[model samples]
Target chain A: MEESNWEPKVIGFLCHWCSYAGADLSGSARLEYPHNIRIIRIPCSGRVDPMFILRALQNGVDGVLVSGCHPGDCHYQSGNFHARRKFAVINRLLKYVGIEPERVQFSWVAASEGPKMAQVIGEFVEGVRKVGPNRLFKDEKKDGE
Target chain B: MENRLKEEAGKLLKEGKVDYIVGYGKGTVNLRTSPLITNKEEDLEGLVINPFIANNLSRYPVELKGRVGIVVKGCDSRSLTSLMQDKKVKREDLIIFGVPCEGVVDLKKLAGQIGAEIDRVTDAEKEGENLTLQVDGSKKTIPFRDVIFDKCYGCEHPTPLEYDMLLGSEVAPNLDIEKSLERIKELEGMDAQERWNYWKEQFSKCIRCYGCRNVCPACFCERCFVDVNMPQWVATYATWQDNLTFQLIRTLHVAGRCSDCGECERACPVGIPLRSLQRKMVEEVKDLFGHEVGIDKDAPPVFSHYEATDPDEFMK
Candidate 1:
């Protein structure tokens, strides 16, 4: 519960073609963002199932970030569009069930949008920081151990 | 209505029309009806059109092969249309007899209202908005709304829209939307953390029986995600954490397909109000996707297709 030692752990599912390249671009351009997120490269945003987000939360991750190509810019053609529809429902369901809106986030970052990627991560990490640590979905029996 | 249904069922069996006639027959227990699956004309004599015909016969025909004649109420027909969209069952193979349902009684609510066990009721007759009952030797009357399931208060179609034959005339939809969605409104009224704690306690009582999954018509997957050990999408134990995860995944899986049949809530042994979560999602799907579950036979499944102009305010 000490303020200095608490850091939010975020899991980012980055699409292979766009968001992953954008992350690489941000690093190449010498932009500094919060190092809170651990990135997982996925084939496309459509491949990110709602189960993945729930599983991440269950594993005690403080937040989940699903980054894909913009609405019309998916490499596989409409994969991001499909992802949008799925995330809309999942996002609403999670909020209705009482999960904080800051815990799970989605965004668009193209390969050229290195500054946008840096900015998005900075904002997301700050939001997760405000929400603090994720103790909600963890297995309670294992806490004392 | 009872005699007409029996006569029609017998005529079909005599004509060698269907391999099975799926309907409800009088159960051995008082005030309970069991599903009747038979090919004989004699079994047609057991058919009863009581308010207690609770089982949704739509899912029963899924495992049965060959031509089938099944009885369906308003909500059940919507479930049948959903199955048809999924290509799970051929519409031509099914000869559906639609029953214009007033509503089915919730025996627990009935017992609670009477301040006695429901088994004491020897006769129940529905006359308009009043329900006449004979409990032991005394006669008591009550309003139908007092003893009906909450889902019935939100019934959109009392008569089946998709049926091969109509057993009765069309009945108008009598909706008490606020009454049906009372539990949902209560959840919505809570702060986020309180809502989470409420569900946490509710799912904690789950015994991992998988009764809700088995009874859902939309959950016809050849293999469920929880069954996979390679990845172990969910732990195969009774921890409240895993149970909550399992239910969350299950609810998302059935978002646009579930017709709010209320079978899952009835099947739950621990008395979890599973319908609260499901019914909430049903309204969410309609608001976001502009799609109502199983209402249109020609429409595609919600998740399988996407619109270019879908809501994306949730995304950054």
Candidate 2:
């Protein structure tokens, strides 16, 4: 299919204390992962409001991944815990609207797991590729030409 | 419905008790009764009370301070109760001429049935079992059972729950609350993912007009969390995420206190079923704490007061 031939545009939000550092380590280790993932570092996972994810999708991004500190390991202690409950709500909302749930991913990535980060991104990119582009929002516009 | 309501308004103006009398008048448009605050007695001629008055005129008591008189129906009186709970208005500062509501006509539904825009429907009469609308161009007869608001269906509480000067016969509260109960029960059966998807579709269409918050009589917060920018809780942008955050926060904030007046649903331009969320939250509050809003002023919020016997399963 023509969709598999094109590289997916994936946006990732990484917590500064853990997930962001993990990405940096992955780069230092010369690990190979899909370059489609564009990482944005935030102070904590709690700072990533549901608005960011919706804005990204509305702007034509194919997928979103929010990675934070492992459970109970947040730099602010309960930041990731709050984030977990919030994302659960957002995930439910997105799926209900007929958008494929595979397009949005949420997982924990500790700072030390550089190889694991690379593997996770690779799997996410593959999953997003299989889902193809989001047609729900795109169809809202007219003018086929 | 009473000569005293108009007489008192004239007396209040002549006695200089108030600056204005906020009441209902014949709508300049078709079929609707619009709210009017008149300082003159001649303007009071348009004032008439019947099943057609649907607005919660008690809301103006807070904003139109310094002594005012408002026409109250049963649901409108709840706004008055909520306003007093928040201390937005003082009881002694105003006069309430409460009317016993048999039921208010749902003008939107009535318009659809009659196939004509209701332009100043005056002289509505209950003839046997049907309501006859006296419109400008034509007289349309609609069944009394049809065109009444769903909230008023089998509603025995047609009289104002509370009033200073009663104007009509007292009405009783209809005991049928099964319809609202059934809707919540149906939603509870959906899986988590299915529920999430359902709400996402509903909330994604939000235009973020903030009409729901503005129209809510209980939502009298000086600085709504959505409007605050110091911490920047929810984004100001009109994205689905921001919209969801705004709705969830508003729903949770009014969980135990929402009166389910259906004002938010009526005010929405997009026709979003806001009552679903508000009613859902109210049902949850009732099931969890056995609390119903607008019942007593002294009772604390459901979340604020927790018993030792409370279930701790949701708590990690």
Candidate 3:
């Protein structure tokens, strides 16, 4: 297959105990995945404030993926659970305001699910490509002044 | 109603129950009311209630230091509840004088009807359904419905929902839930790109005055995210991106907390239809979490506490 000229810029906010470890394991296991995502490790998914996702979009990132531990599996016992509820409201609000629903994605990736993390990244990049570059709230300041 | 309000306010001050009364007094400009804080019994004469009393006096109790007797209409009373929930003001510190509101006039709408700048409104009175306004030397009497603020048309509580003392008889709510949701429904019917363009046009007009934020009773944060400089949560520029960020973040911050008092919309100088954004969140909170803000002070904020069975259909 010919490589596409477009490469979507994806920002992944990964919980340290779960999704971050999962991404690291994917690296150690040499599982190939799209290089589109730039990972930001956070203490817990609950720490991923909706502002961060919105800021990333405003800064012209093509997509945002927030991954945390599955329910009942959070290291802090309830962080991911709390994050799940917040993401639900944020996602709905974004969609209601005319943002592409696919621009912001949420999922659960346990520490051991290295291949799963790779799959999530690949799919998110593809989905964002289908929607094209995000112009919603994009900063209009010219690059490098 | 005005005489009763003044008498009750005087009684509260004369009895030394409150250090001051937060009510509306005559503004420097005619036909305008300003938030007045007074402790003198004689000053109660300045306290007035009219269709022009658009100021929400709820935030005064939180900002002022001392026992305050605040005059609250239905919407103002709800805002007081939100303040109490946030611990910004204590119930004991406030002597709430509840007034049954018959809707306040929208100054802009009235100005538009008159067709010229109102240099001064010599006199104004609401008699039954007609608003008699003495503009300059000519008197214009318009139907009250034609000049009343849009927020009042769908008021669910025309009288204070909760108050220590009732100043007047309870008024029946002119509750039109559909009317409140009409704008939201219209926006929802638009395609995504159309909606985006619509908001972009609106946000582009923002001057970043922060009038909406300042007027909100729920926006009691000591350091708003927009003002933070260390990590700059949102840029201070007047660009559309920054304006959109400020609005979206502020809405999220007040989700399940905003009382839908319409103060933000009323305070906006550019007429951004802020209530539309806020009401959308209000409806979403009600639909998803089954909670309405500023109703029960005992209940925790919707986002602060989550039920085990809270809907998570949007989650993976």
Candidate 4:
């Protein structure tokens, strides 16, 4: 890369029951991971509407990561499963319309899997860095760049 | 078939069986039809089922409060079935008149082929498989397949699957889905940037008219997300970015529910290829869930119910 220090700004939506707690556990353990991600705690990944991801992209976030309980381990019986259906459709659709697939990622991170969460973030940020900035909705008129 | 439909509609109104008869009548313009909604017995004579009846009447029954007798072609019936599946319309509350359709003519193709405006054509008569057009004292003939709507190419249901009375004999589907989806495959063949730019250019022409939303039978939201300004989901302005946002959100919103009716594309005034996005989603939903929309009236909506073994390769 030109600058060699340009880190990607990624937004992580973590479910309160699993992925959020996993982030907490990673912090407690003093894990070594990239600080490029800003986490938003949600009740469940099922609550992450497809609009939220699109808004993040439109708002110019470099990447978006949605993490929740593993299938069948949802806090609300079938929340993750429902979320999976939406994710499947949205991911395919977003990429079909030419958004970089690496810009959005979905993962499962249980409370006990703190190391995995750190590693997931590390890998996701690296992938985002490869894809470069989010220019999908760049408003040249407003930005005046 | 037209006589039988008129007689049955007359009987329905005369016997107070339905509160309204939703069908099509000859529009003032040549080679066009407007939705004909009426409760009077005299209007039955105005009902004309022809090759030019293109508008899907399924969206009407959802709003009409009382008992309704609506006419349906293949795609319109599927849309009705989808609305019924969602409990938006009750079966007992309405009577359905099924018209066995070969395929409706596409006016845009006709205009382009004849190198003239659709309104200029004085008369269009269907003779078996060819259309004889009388344009300014000149008679020109064209095959029916060359001018039919793209959705009609692969229509799976040429007759209503669940109708009280059959207007005519059931016809076979042409099964030329590839012919309709040619544009979609072209888009997919492009690289990410090219595809994005293609849609950007298409959406830039959008004037923010909600014609696509209004005509879509699946877009039956009472309070659409776009109308709500509390959170200000999408900006009201007609900026190209917001237009893209509006269509992207709309396409996602009607993912499984969309029957690929092509009404949204047909309704676009600026000639955006909206059917490509919708038809692509149809392909994805079909591949992802093996679920064809509006096929069965009893099953739960595609997203409401999920299989335990659903594809999870995309997720971590």
Best by DockQ: 1
TM-score winner between 1 and 3, please give it.
1
* Model 2: per-residue Cα lDDT over B1-316, one tens digit each: 5576777778878888877788887676655678888878788777867666766777777777578877888777766765666667777787778888777788787878877666656557777569987776468788976777666753435677767778867866654566535555566677644665666677778888999888877677879988888867777877665676577667666665676777787778877677767776655566555776655545554544544343323221
User: Which residue runs of candidate 4 sit more than 4 Å off their true CA positions?
Assistant: A1-5, A141-145
Model 3 lDDT tens row, B57-105: 8988877889999989998898888788888999899888888998988
Query: Model 2's DockQ?
Result: 0.07
TM-score of candidate 3's chain B against its reference? 0.95
Which residue pairs clash within candidate 4?
A: none
A best-first ranking of the candidates according to their lDDT comes to: 4, 1, 3, 2
| Candidate scoring better on DockQ of 1 and 4 | 1
Error of 2 at B299 (Å): 4.1
Identify the runs in model 2 with alpha carbons over 4 angstroms from their true place: A1-145, B39-42, B120-123, B134-139, B154-156, B180-186, B298-313
Model 3 lDDT per residue over A1-145, tens place: 1236767899999999999999999999999889999999999999999889988998889999999998888888788777776887788788877899888999989999999999898988999999987767654565322
Name the better of 2 and 3 by lDDT.
3
Q: Can you tell me which runs of candidate 3 are displaced by over 4 Å?
A: A1-4, A138-145
Using TM-score, rank the candidates from best to worst.
4, 1, 3, 2
Query: With candidate 1 superimposed using the best TM-score fit, by how many Å does residue A70's alpha carbon deviate from the native?
Result: 1.1
Question: Which lDDT value does model 3 have at B169?
Answer: 91
Stretches > 4 Å off in candidate 1:
A1-3, A139-145
Q: Which ten residues in a row have the lowest lDDT in candidate 2 chain B?
A: B307-316
